[model samples]
Target: MPKITYITFDETQYDVEAKEGATVMETAIKNGVPGIEAECGGACSCATCHVYVDEAWAEKTGEPGAMEEDMLDFAQDADERSRLSCQIKVTDELDGLVVRIPESQA
Candidate 1:
């Protein structure tokens, strides 16, 4: 498992272990990270799982796929670092990764 830390806009943080092959959103929802609704069950149909990848992890995570890129269009306050949590698959190399949750989702 990888330790992923979700940092809220208000500075609150929730750290959870994410198993390989599970999406980041799955670890988040499982650990009660506030703000990521994952309303579509990570099917890429909803924009509720929005998150801002920490600058350090952005390059490692790579660019979003076409579907995630399109769904990001509907997210609140999407930016260059914005990503749908469902698109981030967990991996051991992602240990200690940090992501920031937007206020809009809270």
Candidate 2:
């Protein structure tokens, strides 16, 4: 299991033990973490599950694909670090992944 930390707009942190192969949005939703709406149900068609990947983990998480980047245009406060949680897969390599939920979703 990977340990994922979700930081809310107000800086509230929710650390969860995420199952391997599950998307970050799924882990957050299943663990009751606030701020990730995931309205598209991990379909990668919406920005409701937007999150900012910590700079330290950016390279490991990789860049967003064209489709995901397009969807991120709809995300509030989208930036270089912005990523849709639904598009982030969990793995042992991401053991300490940290993401921050934008205030718009808080």
List the lowest-lDDT window of 10 residues for candidate 1.
89-98
- After superposition, candidate 2 runs with Cα above 4 Å error: none
TM-scores across all candidates? 0.97, 0.98
Off by over 4 Å in 1: none
Which lDDT tens digits does candidate 2 get at residues 1-106?
Answer: 7899999999999999999999999999999999999998999998999999999999999999999999998998899999999999999999999999999997
Among the numbered candidates, top TM-score falls to: 2
lDDT per residue (tens digit) for residues 1-106 in model 1: 6899999989998888889999989989988899999999999989899999999999888899999999999999999999999999998889888999999988
**CA lDDT of every candidate:** 0.93, 0.95
Model 2: lDDT equals 0.95
